[model samples]
Target chain A: MSSSGITPITKSVTPIPASATVVEAARLIEAEQSTLPVVDEAGRVLGVVDSASLLKALVPRYLEQLSHTGFIRQDPAGLLRHALQAAQQPVCDVVQTLPEYLQEGASEAHAAELFLHTGVLAIPVVDADGGLVGVVRRVDLVVALATD
Target chain B: MAELLAVGVFVLAIALIATERLHRTVVALTGGAFVILIGLIEQEPAIAAVDWAVLGLLAGMMILVWGAQQTGIFTWLAVAVGRASGGRPAMLVLGLTGSTALLSAFLDNVTTVLLVVPVTLVLADTLDIDAAPLVVAEVIASNIGGAATLIGDPPNIIIGSAANLGFVDFLVHVGPPAVLGYAAAMTWLYVRHGRQLVPEKERLEALASLDPTAGLGPRRDVVIVLACTGLTILGFFVHGLFHLEPATVAMSGAALFLLVGRPDVETALEGIEWTTLFFFGGLFVMVGALEANGTLERVAEALRDVTGGNRTAEVLGIAWTAAIASGLVDNIPFTAAMVPVVRDLSAEGSDVTWWSLSLGACYGGNLTLIGASANLVAAGALNRANRPLSFVSFMKYGIPATMISMAIGSLWLLLLLAVE
Candidate 1:
């Protein structure tokens, strides 16, 4: 839909295993940019893990229902210490539904729309057979749009 | 032909909803439309079938309560109750759930659970205690408390409006049993979780150190919302004296809040539960077509024949049957379908028939995890937090507590028969 073609970054980003724990996913997310494609041993894309998904598993789930968390202390009784089991949870459990992704040969306009809707820093780009091709970084997509 | 068309569509809608295959609103609207399109009910009559009083009451309360919660009053209330529990594990759980019930008696149960469940999860998480028992307890308590007043639950609103009953009328008839039901459910919860929820010294320290008034603020806004809420409850109490419907009282309460709070009209309108309102409208039209075509009377006649015209069997049959059906389906649409049937069954002017139906539908909703809207919302919240509550786990708690509560309701109905 756009004049500029999307430059999907296939080489730079790394994918994590589907069975990785939240802490392992968190470690990978911190090492790379936010979202890392999640794949099976055969390299089929099962899902993706990003900062948001990791934090979602760590924080109290009901905070989204309230406008304010002012009523309680942050570390009320060593909150993170209590999250040991939560940290050990497989990343797939925290993955909301499945990952929304961009298909290969998609336009910059299509990539931009996916970013806007998903609010993720990077989106996994998949092929017609649903194999992980690459991830389109939001920053790179925006830069291409500016120059095109 | 007309009666068959109406009954067929209603049956299809119920099947689709229970199967959870399509959006319930879509199923209801489709059912409503099919009857009219096939000429089973005329356009004018179908439009007339929607109960404006129930819609008005739901809309008004939705706006008033959602608007009031924006000021953080509910958060402050939750923390204050936690502080009041004084670090005792049982009291802390009971205080939170007890508050959920009491607030549910006055407001919508959905709103009550939405406001309180989050803080409860957090408090539970802070202590590293399992939140399932407490969350499920709150949900069950909400349905029981919702039976106490006219505006407390959706089923009651429909029954009260159709039966021409008032706030105090429901309180007098259903309130005592609801109190007993709540106590029975709470006692069951205590026995199940009280011994298991033993808190260590550190967890006790966390409970003792909470601040109650941390979220109380934006003083002017809080005062306005609370005042509006109080005036709304007062209006419900005195609505009978004014020769006004509960719908009018609720709308007045919403309007008063709007006038004082001065929030944007567009924003305020967005807060209303338009989907639920539309779902109810569709159900009414479908049920209305059934009424117009004489299907509801036939069902009532069948019931009467089955009971051999024994008054006690008739009432208890309706009460127990409602509990079982509501658990299988949902309470809202089930109650809508039964309204016309109950109307045909009741004596020309007595409200006793309405009472049995109300208690059955509301208490019976506690029978399963998916039995009520509140249950699903709580379970969903837990899911988001990485602790998915399985259906079997919830049913383990749901069935026993509901059985006890329903028994209490049955006992009360029997006593009413004895007294008469």
Candidate 2:
């Protein structure tokens, strides 16, 4: 069985637009799934956004400079205000542009390889033209392997 | 031809080390091997030149410090000082600087700074202040403090071993000047940067909330390590009376700790900085090659001509020249090269010039970020914590600190010479 057999790309899977705000993307991910594909106007897959990416986007840029040092707790009121301000940024600004994706015609073995290498729970499946096709999740790969 | 080749290689090694484009140990070891390969020095002499006392002292002290670190005693002591300051930023800085200087006088400056700077940074964060000034102050203080004792700085260790000076001799001669220089440096730091470290209300609250005693390790380990360190220091005092070397005292302490503490010997040994040990080994051989040839004698002759047998001129000249040279290069290698030259300048029993060289070389390290191993290690720790201390920024503080400290050192030396 190839990746096409395990892809969950029915008509209900709607890709988020690049122009959407981070809150909009987050709401969509919350409503549908943890992972959402970000597509440009021409239906080309631009990147992927997930709950983890959204949380990362809400963090102040300066905090990245604190390499290896653990996070310092801020006042809750200030942290909420900062996070709310970050929620208005464009999804494209916070999306993981280099996310791992699988081609629709790829095999289940290839899907397993990508999952192991990237350590991601789910990977977006794209067409040959790089259009959003579907997603292959870890659970889907596990079912496919079990049946094989 | 062999002498020329050896000198060329030595120069190249120093150039590489100054440029910092490569690791210093690699360059030093390569230069040492090249000198031997070209027949400037043979195998046995090179082996004999390694200064095993300095290496043994370094290794043993490293083991002792490493074991003590596992007990978290250094952090506890620093935090206790911070608490005593009552969250006042200036007092905290003064206390930390003073503590670092005192600890550095007995310990390796690099290890002393390594243990102290991190705690200082945490304290600075609690105070919600920039740590750059405080960290830089500690770096300078550590170098100065190390100058006061025979085993404090590597150059002092080399000087003590080479000149056969005892621990008490260094304490009596160099200790007073080091204390005066420390006072001058701390005064300058407060005058220049004290106002910038004022703690905000929220920062003061945060500082008050910190539990200084929370991180102190097991009580048994603390007691054992503290006892070991105390006895080791005491041993340094009486080692001369017993006709024992400092290395013997240090290694015995280290061995006793290892036996009692029962820390994994393999893991504890791994903490020893073998690279630094090897660097010392290689540098000694390279300097040995220079001595094997007549190159050191030529340098000495040139210096003698310049001084014209004027004792005052010779004393001041050696001190100031060493300060400037140490600022530009690693003081260890500079001290290594100057040791022979200083010997040639003075008679066997006269140790005035040796003290001058030690004071200048030790204090000269405060001139630049790259001047000493301690400064570089502190800077590296700062960089790792994402508080990047730029070289130019450090020089703004370093240049004045060096000038004031070196001036005090010179005056002290001159006064000592006059009295004698």
Candidate 3:
């Protein structure tokens, strides 16, 4: 078989349980090349929670108050307040979706497509059972291409 | 007056769906809700015309499909086919596409493709082709095959229920054309990718290494799922031919399958695409609004004015229009909305024109990338597996395959209508 210049890379994935604290999330993100890990607790992937998800999670009584006003604060202090509040929130509070999650795959092409479509710099590749396998990043592809 | 507003809303919904700007089911359900609201105010037949039987049929079929998938029966079949073909790249394509087409006629094409694509990718890696052509062939074949049965494609389901058409009706009217189209698809693949076939020994090795277990189930699971599918297909035909409602037959089949297998009810329910059902409901309401607003009547009148009530001219016009419209829009809504229009035209003179519209709408999806829900679902499944099927990539086969099918459909209709 002919090999292409694009070699599938595997490394630096960050995963946490949905119950992990914001400090834990921030540490994992900082440790793992600054990319968010897909979180799960008790073997179920709750969506990936990055800084954005963490911020969303911080807002108390999100579902209780359906008014749009809570979502529309623009002051820097208000944004900081939201972020700080989000930091206190549980990972489940800011989950991206339901039982069936949209995730990346182990294939190089799969990684590239996810990156292109979702605009994520890196994506968490999962096994068929939804366990974290590894991470594929833009830099990985770029490096592989450059060496080739 | 209010009807016009509903129609404008419906058109906007169609545009959003066709452009892939939102989930189709969402768009459809929104349209259905709007129509229901309008119906409450206008107090028209919109509510009466909603056809809960069709909705029930769709819901039951979806659950049946989910049961089959849960068992990994389809995945096992794809693996068996790949092994039987010895993984020769060309034979693999023929086997996978042929089998996919056959299954798609009874089961959902998306489920069929989802099962087949991963196996094909493994086979492709073994034979060492780009895998794109094989993927493309399977999708096109799935679409064509699904066109032959009343319950095969989504648009067919809508058309069948709306027209009170049955399984035998589809087989008599659309089956022959579908066969011809499948043959053409094989030929197309042969010309495009035949040279890429590898050695028999290498092919055998590739076949041996193939493991379809990525989503496989227990042996008991497989047996029960296959039995359920077999019964459902049988029920679809029996119910259709014997004057039983298709919805009744489908729901009965689903209840039996679930009861006998004793699968997880919660998982099966979750697996059902509720959003899609909502979308269908929405589309019904939107179409209802159009019907109430006189938009369909106005269009029918315009067509009558053009054709001078000549049935042949009208049939030809409706067929080609359906084909063209399907290329640019989601054929389910387009065909569903057109059902009454075609019916009125047929009533104005002869009933042959409705069949033409049915054929056009059903088969016309082969004309473009976004033509049918089956096409989109297949494309989405493959793309999820790391192989994105682009519009240009799909049209490479879709355009030609559609032309051939439409031509054959026209000729077959001419013969059928003329002889009888």
Candidate 4:
């Protein structure tokens, strides 16, 4: 894939298992400061969970349908309790399924389209069997274009 | 013979739509193209067949509703109703479902339910009660409330435009039945689920602590949208007096909002349910072909023969048939096919067929999970909230609601016929 241009940094990111708790996934992201791919036992990617998805998980799921949240006010203690309860669910439940992903040997333009279309933090680069080859972070794609 | 072929294709499409084997829009569009492609009628007549006025009205209202929706006013109203209910189970149920009916009276039922169901699911969660009952009631109320006004439901819109009826016409003929049906539906709901809606004391306290106005958008946008909504409804009422169609009134409101609201033109236009409008377009062409071939007149004559040509029997028969057919299939296509037949059945210049069809079709939408778009939309919302309402489960409530509404509508039609 890099033959055409800069490719995903395979060594920089960490992968989280599909069965991991939302708390575990959040911690992994905090420690890595990168998007985490949720993978099954065979190392196939299910979807990616990132800070945005994690933030979504912390609130009531109904918030997804609501147009505004400015009115939702809770005491910190109560809100923390709610978030903790929310974080205990399996991370798979909150994973944002990647619709447009980069395949092995795909060009950088495909990567840019996924970023532009989904506005996702990262686009997973998968192999033929849907194994996680790597992810191209939004920053990496932008910087590659800027400096190319 | 080509008319028979056209009829066959249209029936096959409706069956496919009823089964949901394909997207209704796709099926409708295909059916339309097949009839014309095979020369069922010429291109010019097919173009003439599509009711551009009804499509215009639907599109305009969609933009207007979305503009108001952006103000977060519906959400705010729903929340405010919940807060005002004092978390009392009876009051809460009544308030939530009642507000849904009120909203459906002005906006289309789908938009009404889309806004109300989410708030209901959230409120149910906060109060720790089952949301299913509340949602079912709201959906049923949506159909009934939609029947009372010309702009409230698609079936009524098609009926009004086809028959040259107006907003005031529907309110005079169907509004009373709608109010009675709402009462009957609410009573049935209370009787069936009253014992189960009890929220925990602690949850009630938590709910009370939340502010109802918290979700409101900017004050300015809310005021403007509300004023426009009021004006749109007002325009619908008097448009006939000014020699205007309802479509013109709705489009004018939409244009005014676009000019003043300054919402992204793209976003505002995006709110239109293009698939539905297109589906109506295709269905209209197919129905027009049927009308051109006198298929609808045959249907009308056969229907009249069944009722022995008595005006009272004719009115009640059309009403009940429209209800059952609408319940079994999606109401839009059924109403589309029936409009011409209703026109044919109208004897000596009476408008009773129009009102009966409107009331029966709208009431019938409460009969099954597949009966109306609003019901299906609510089911999807509930399923998303992990509170799935199945087809059978819906019918347990739906059957009685339909029966009650139908009974009321039939009697009201009969009473009107007797009086006149």
Candidate 5:
């Protein structure tokens, strides 16, 4: 009910659903340095986004023109813009949700393992009902320990 | 004349390895080429003594490790350990050290350390603790742990093959001392770094927040391979039933694992450490050339003379001297070259010299930060991961741990010799 203990600067940043595209994800990430963006729908956490997943989505752009010609009605660059602009898709659709995802009620050590396993900077924290609580960034953890 | 050349090549090999500016495989390969070019070793004899068996075995194991890493199992297991320890520094240290030792005994120390380090760094970062000490503990634990089994450390592998010592032979003989050495190391860590414990509450909160699904991957046939591994270790001691080489058994197990529901070919190939394999292949040729040129024989005679032909005194002398030398030079060559010396010493009535050599070469590696390949690999890996583990800082813990373990090893060697 109260987010007072949470870093005040992180409180106002809203999490988007996993369906969001690279364009939208990048925008959200840039707007605030919220390293973790929990993907949710109707308050149920589906997946999370970090810098890694965002960078991964941008890699296929060069191939889009050749591979998706029949599928696209617009020009290549226009298609790229459209792909980047569409934000309705949930984060889970693009997010790496397997194996490294931190489950609700998991320990910090478990979270650490996920980061190591995936070579990611942050992991999404979920609650008992698979609902989004908040994100735990690597820097956040470091800051916590440094301050504690 | 040829003997001098061999010694020169050997020294160059050590220098190139110590400077770290060149890849080890390259340095060794270049040294191997030097031997061939100088005709220090003829082509026929060079190929004859070149132990492809050792290289094959190392390659097979590297592929196995690569496969395991691909599955993310080790990292996952590390996470589980971290989760269980809940960031209590002492408990975390104990868990990391114990697990690393156990795993290193079964796998190559470098591969094992490489797999575990990332997880350790993540734990350190998440816990907001400096990971240097934990990493240091891992390096020490890995060396000690690898000493427990015949197939664990590179020197042990060579010893096993050279002496025809079995896995059980290593477990019964060297294993106990390795465990004892591990205990001594733990005590040292407690006295030095135990006060740096992080809060328990923070650990619990962190534990409660992990998302497991993010890292899950397909599980391979872990059960069968583990059983085969157990059989392989069992075969080490029970040589009476059969005369199978440990490498043969390892290869057989690996083959069976592949033939019967193993991971894909690409995955299976991941287990081998090719760079290390190349390094070993090249080193064999270099050392072989020295042996051929009669340089190794001269060095052996000199060492024998220095110890006054007192076998027990010689074994202890070599053991202590190696412990000191490894802190300066790469232990792999030091140990490899000593294999023949120890063999000769044993042939001359000091049967315990081989074991002493094994103990010295393995434990002596812990004396300095750069004393062992595993230490260097761990440092490089940590640095690449943006969490650098410095040499001076590593020595802060390494020096004492090395002294304690080496002392125990020296005393143990004396006991083994006295009883004989």
Candidate 6:
């Protein structure tokens, strides 16, 4: 277990560029995983753009009409226009800067601790130079624990 | 020397609070301790100086309000009132301000505005209007509402406890002026923004979709809170009959609610505003030190000389002075410092002055954005929602509303003086 490699999943995970459009970032996030690490030109992790953040950014502002007496009608076209406009912006504008992360060689226990404390679906792993290495998914940690 | 030390500590605490450099509770508690440490007040005297009744009453009511909050009653009421307005923006503004004022009169002003402002914002958004004007009006109204009752505003609570004035006494003396001021304020609000509040048909149709009861918790919990609050208010009215302080009534209600409602005790207690309670406790000791050292008497004499024995002039002077000072600084400490001065100013049958002080300090809070805790809290909520209120923007509404309310308050005081 100590010698187990994380490279299998790391190789398969695609890192998103900081300049990528919101649509591109969203597609990458949905097809690949919940979070796609946004990397700069030098492969340094700039931020992470997740599916939830994309949805939040793209969603049009609507009045929270919580009254049961009647329905507030919203224009579908307005919502679509808002979403399309948002999708044209670079993902960097909407990305959440990484707060903390695990190192590339961090133990499964350490990875689990980061996952638990940060409450993220996955922990971004960076190399000694702080370049994006891979992400340790919660599923990956669970699998590591089960196999051990 | 001891008197100088006490005054120094008191002034420093006020400075710290005004500057917002430290948490106010910290500044107050440290000042209270410094007074004891420097021998201005001894341990026994400091303990004696602390108004346990006011502290207990504040804590007890906080607990009851917390219990009610756990049941989401405030939100339910807000949504219900918003729906009742039928999404007419002007009517919605009126309803929200009225509800905020009424709630602030009984509950904490900060809490009242905190609950109501979000709902107001949502209503504003639904109606395709900016929330700033409605929120500003609510902030002003909350302070006016709070001034009307002994338990409504912290200043009134401190003044009530100091003067041994009953809840009924405050209602009788202060309530009328507060109501008048509220009406004047609402009129100004309407005149300023009534046209802007006209609702679009689409927004009105959208507001009908809101469910007032969406977040209201269990029926039994709501019932328990309502019953406890109702009994507590009733107890406040008749506590004098049982030789009980209002604090005892509040504490008993809280205990009963906890016992019957079966809420998680830890969760229930967590909502208590301990910082505010501590701040009050410390302020009482600081004021007591001033009282002990004859400083209050000297200040009162100075004020008496200034007024030249004219009762009407004296009342108006304190009201206007307090209003301006409260607008510039936090009112709780100003009221605490002035309570002793006002007490010293009162001769036989001089109850009218107390009403003036209450009116001045409470209404003056509407003069600036930072005038009252309620205003600050509402501004904070707005800022968090990305709709920050500027000092200039707030005062545009706040200053005129304050001037108008202060004018009405002064007139009412003179009328009371005339009647007397």
Model 1 residue B358 lDDT score: 94
List ranges where model 2 is wrong by over 4 Å: A1-148, B383-387
Cα lDDT tens digits, model 3, A31-127, are 6555565566645455565665554454332222221122122222222444475575556555554233224434455555656666555556556
> In terms of docking quality, how is candidate 2 classified?
incorrect
Query: lDDT tens digits, residues B1-420, model 6?
Result: 777777888888888898889999999898888788877877898899898988999999999998988777887777778879996766777788888889999999998987788777666666666677888999999999999999999889888888889899898889988898899888888888877777777666657776778778889999999999999999988887888888999999999999999989999999899999999888888988988888888899999998997898899999999999899889998999998899888868768889999999999999998889888887876764446899899999999999998998898999989898
Question: What is candidate 3's CAPRI-style docking category based on DockQ?
Answer: incorrect
Each model's RMSD to truth, in Å?
2.9, 5.6, 16.4, 2.8, 16.8, 3.4
Which pairs clash in model 3?
A14-A37, A58-A85, A58-A86, B28-B282, B29-B279, B32-B282
Q: What is the alpha-carbon lDDT of model 4 when measured against the actual structure?
A: 0.85
Clashing residue pairs in candidate 2 (N, C-alpha, C atoms within 3 angstroms): none
Task: Please write out the lDDT profile of model 4 over residues B1-420, one tens digit for every residue.
Answer: 977987898789888988988999999898888888888878999999999889999998999999988988888888888878877878987898888887898888998998988888777777777889999999999999999899899999999999999999889889899999899888989888977788877777767766767778789898888888789889998999999999999999999988887889998899999998889988998887888888888999899888898899888888888888888898898899999999888866689988998988888988889988899999998876667899999999999999998898989998889777
Ranking by DockQ: 1, 4, 6, 2, 3, 5
Candidate 1 on B106-187: residue-level lDDT in tens? 8888889888888887777666677788888999999999999999999999999998999999998999999999988888
TM-score of 4: 0.92
Best by lDDT: 4
Best by DockQ: 1
Q: What TM-score number comes out for model 1?
A: 0.91
Q: Report the TM-score of the second chain of model 6 against its true counterpart.
A: 0.97
lDDT by residue for model 3 over B54-142, one digit each (tens)? 78888888888888776666666676677677756666777888899898888667666666666565555455455667777787788
Using all chains and alpha carbons, the TM-scores for the candidates as numbered come to 0.91, 0.80, 0.72, 0.92, 0.72, 0.90
Single out the weakest 10-residue window by summed lDDT for candidate 1 chain B. Answer: B195-204
iRMS per model in Å: 2.2, 7.2, 22.1, 3.9, 16.5, 6.5
